[model samples]
Target: MTNHTILEPLREDQWFIQSQELRSFLAKVSEISAHTVDDRTQTLARLEPYFQELLVQQEWLPQKFAQVNPESRMGGGIGQWLLYRAKNQSLSIFSLVIPPGSTTPVHDHLAWGLIGLYKGNQEETVYRRVDNGDAQGHAQLQITEVRRLKTGDIYRLLPPDGDIHAVKTTSQSASVSIHILGNDTGCIWRHQFMPESHSVKSFRSGYSNAPCEEEEEKEHALH
Candidate 1:
């Protein structure tokens, strides 16, 4: 079996800093998500407008969270920084920074979420998995769409349909996108695909700012 780490929910909501804009957005998301908890489609639909509003507001995100990480967990100078996570672990907000000319591995987010370009530009290549998933460590994916997204562009991840994809920064500077997900995205094990090799593997791209349980344990041991 693939080794996976399960993280317990935090005792209280965690915020990197106190920002009124983020607080207001989180409140709206919580309110909308509570009622439509059973239906992910409706939840994402309801959350889109609020997410769009957050994306359009430029000054809310601090520069530190938007900067690229040299030791990126996702590689290619892709930094995933956590800004906020609900106490129950049902909601999370983060910024993904991709340096210019860098591309993320084709990956899947196994939860419903919204990804919006906060700065710069990106080329997103969305894919569809074709195999039945019976074979181990193997997956076949076909490109469904290639989208060029500029600042303020938004997209949705509704799984089994528009889930698997790769993104590359196509601008002079790094591209920063905001992700509001239903799960603790970077901490949980997900799939990363190798299209040319027709292979897949379990991957956990931990946040640059927030360490996972295993990472925390290692840090304690080293001290």
Candidate 2:
């Protein structure tokens, strides 16, 4: 579904955080065929109840996430890692950890996305693409809604609901969440919007941690 080299696996260096519950979730994700966007949406919905259990278990997270500094200018002032992606056009799962005061630039996901907050707090604003006035070929976005999410809050970003938004950590501690998206998001050509200039730019956010040996080889070949 994405335009980049596909990565397939359940874990890499991220294995240190795996649990039976997570493995079970992966098993369900594996059954998904990814034939259509709606099909994938329903698939993720089926696991919503189990995903709550994941929110309750906070010990499995890697320590590196807590150590991440919100002030770091690196990687959008946050930490992220790609835990898995289906070999074919199935799904991509990743984690985003944002420390207090960390925020991301306003952007849009070309594919469907679901975010489940497991720790701390966050505030997000959703935007509607009102115009594409960027002479340089970018989108113009308008804020549609703003919401604060706490642990176990699941936010949906499917079409028809204005999928563009900017996210920020509002808690004193680091906020961690599981982001499950359609296709390979890290390598896909998504939109990043500049509110001041009213411009948009294409961007691809690569994996923050590291992929497995097989995935690394495939990624190298793509380059």
User: Mind giving the per-residue lDDT tens digits that candidate 1 earns over 1-223?
Assistant: 2635456777688898668988998998889889998898898888888888888898999999989999997999899999998777778899999999999999998878899999999999999999998899999999999999999999999888789999999999999999998888888898999999999999999999988756777899999
Candidate 1: pairs in clash: none
- Consecutive 10-residue window with the lowest summed lDDT within model 1: 1-10
Give all candidate RMSDs, comma-separated.
Answer: 1.4, 4.5
After the best TM-score superposition of candidate 1, give how far the Cα of residue 159 lies from its true spot, in angstroms: 0.9
The lDDT values for all models are 0.90, 0.68
Candidate 2: give the clashing pairs. none
What's model 1's overall lDDT? Answer: 0.90
Candidate 2 lDDT, tens digit per residue, 1-223?
1234444544422343555777777666555534334565676576666667776888765677445534432354676676666655346777787878878878776666678898889999888887645356656677889999898898776764647888898999878888777766766566677887777766766567654445678899999
TM-score of each model, in listed order: 0.95, 0.78
Worst 10 residues of 2 by lDDT: 7-16
